[model samples]
Target: MWARRRAARQERLDRVAAEAIAEFEARVSSMLATADESHQALLELRELLARELADINGLLAPGGGMPVEMVRAQLEPGDDALAQMDRISAEFTAVRVQVIGKGAADRETLVPLLEDLGGFVEGMGELADNVFGAAEATTELRVNLQDARKDLAPLRARLQPALRAAEDELAATRGAPGWHVRQVALATLGDRLAALEEGRVWPTPEKTTVDLYQELEHELATLRDEIAQTPS
Candidate 1:
């Protein structure tokens, strides 16, 4: 009978130990999951910062007019981003404290802390969106600038010859009827060419350099025809 009682007591102790071990493992698992979430949030923040830096670098590349200091100043993260980072860091530290201090014996403290961690993760996600949103805008601006340059290429090619022709016409028709008109037209064309070369006239989606060049080409052609018909 004593032997049987001892076996029953041994079984109860084993079951209690098993339950305690399971509970401890569960707490550890929760802690690890919280840590992993915090780590992911940090990684996302880092990626966003890197992207912003890359955009600033592009603005400071060759032929770029945006000042490096201005771009760096604009790209600096705002207070919200910094605050989110600090909060996440604090939460991670809290999690570590819970792990070391409680050692699975204290479950209540970690539950609320985990909940706070979740909120922090959500905040971090929102902050990342705000950070990346600015980068996206800069990217769009760069694309528009590139397209403007593309539109200007052919226009520049056609304008060079037109400018030479205008100069030649002015010299050939000196002191003739409507010579002053031709000279004035040539001056106007020269101004436009200079503006384009100096980047004063930027082609937009609404008003492309292609359209402007076509209009100028037509005007120059009409001027040439008029000059040809006039008697010498």
Candidate 2:
């Protein structure tokens, strides 16, 4: 009877321990999901920045008042967030292996790691905000170009040509993969542009709208450039 009692107690202890680990892992997964969402936002912002700069490069006249070198300078802020995310990704993978992948015991150390990760996620968001004068990099570039032009009438008129150009590219390849995403980006960018204020007080966008089309335009675009590269 004593032996059976001991076995039952051991079994209960084991089950309780397993439930604890499962709870811990669920918490960890939720936290890491936040990072994944943030990382993707950084990626889309980086790609959009690259595309807008390239677009501006295409639009500028030779010896155009703005040099490509000048236009490209804006990418600096967001790159750090991307680099930090890469490091976090590696460390996160290692932690995940211990907590969930191997079905191992939860480490007391991981609690500290989780706190640090949460902090890193917050910092990355702040860094991304520095790069966004608006949702897509398009309006940021537009404002830069507008500043050089120094006239709202001409600048406002020029505001949407790039957007129209992007839409036309997607329209040409209707029903193609990533087409829907490009369409959403158009809407996001348009909404952002319409939201622009007269004082040009560029608002810092929420860094967590990973829910936005920015990333969904997944397998996505530099729009015209990507579409051009796509073989008919």
Candidate 3:
């Protein structure tokens, strides 16, 4: 009887200890879950940052001048960057898994890992914000400038031909258009002609929009002459 009584007491003690351990693990799991949330947030932010940086790099490359929104839309599609953020968040969920796998007795071993994960999360968030913000700013500026250039195109085209024609007529007439006529014509043509001469004009394929076609042809002939003179 005494032996049976001692066995029962020992079993009760073991059960109590097991319950204590389980409760401790439950608390740890909750804390780990919160940390995982933060880690996931940081990973998402980093992914978004990387994606934006890539987009801006592509935009800033040679022969690439599309608007920011358009480029962004093309990259992200319907769900946009948010979808990518979600994907990154999911990818970092393994941190939570790792922490949750720790036993009650493993708290000492697990705490440092959880802390490191948190630190990594904070660092990633900072890095992502910095890179994304800079690239976004640069891309926005470029897009705005491109939009302004687009707005100026029609005026540039209309004014260009008239200015070139006036300059040509004045040149052909050997400045004989008289002092007042010459002054008025040159003044009227100066702004647009100067802009053209400075190469601020937009691209217009063929000779259709340009008054300097014949002049360009002459220049091309001169270039051919120079090439011909060079030793083969």
Candidate 4:
């Protein structure tokens, strides 16, 4: 009967899908893990740089919302990284369901998909990926983190180097307002720069990288004279 034939066909498909689904589910798990790691790194970078920027802005007082609030308005890279990762998750889920939907009976043609997915999840162990392959899941997230690094470069090039010159004029001043040189500043600035110097910024201990945030609550405490504040 027609029902019997249909039942047999469905059973064949279920059998064929078992092993392929297991292999692909394993790959999907790896992809999700990579996405997660990238997402967290991007979030940390945004917070670190934006906090520094806020301190600089507070010191300069260009006449706007509170520096902490203004910091939020200017920063969008963290959100961008989140959005991109969400999209990748959606697409990966769709791919997971469809990848061997018809079963992997045709192994040769399926190799490309498997390879591309591997490259994305694990970075291909190469300096350069294939010319026409899917970018690793974290590529944009890495870019966002890099852009955050760039955000702080102006501090070194324009702010810190020039800060020392104005100290003499400010030396006799009282309190922080009369002295732009006594700006509230991040003590972790040097440490952050060193971590980013090698073009990567992970595995850094919280204390070693940005433990001064609590100290920031007492902004006046960090408002040292320029002579003491200048980067060596």
TM-score of each: 0.50, 0.47, 0.43, 0.28
Q: What's the distance in Å from true for residue 183, model 3?
A: 19
Model 2: lDDT to the true structure: 0.57
Estimate, for each residue in 94-162, the C-alpha lDDT of model 3 and write its tens digit.
655776677777768777766765765665466456545554664564465456445545545555565
- lDDT digits (tens) for residues 14-104 of candidate 4: 9778767677567656654664564444445444444544444443233211222323433344345434545554554555455555345
Better of 1 and 4 by lDDT: 1
Instruction: Name the TM-score of candidate 2.
Output: 0.47
* Best candidate according to lDDT: 1
Candidate 2 per-residue lDDT over residues 133-214, each given as its tens digit: 5335565665656554443334445445656766677788777777777678667766654433222222224521122223
Query: What's the ranking of the predictions by lDDT, best on top?
Result: 1, 2, 3, 4
Q: Give the TM-score of candidate 3.
A: 0.43
Task: List CA RMSD, all candidates.
Answer: 7.3, 21.0, 12.7, 15.5
Model 1 stretches with alpha carbons more than 4 Å out: 1-123, 131-148, 202-204
TM-score of 4: 0.28
Superposed model 4: Cα runs more than 4 Å off = 1-13, 62-232
Clash-forming residue pairs, model 2: none
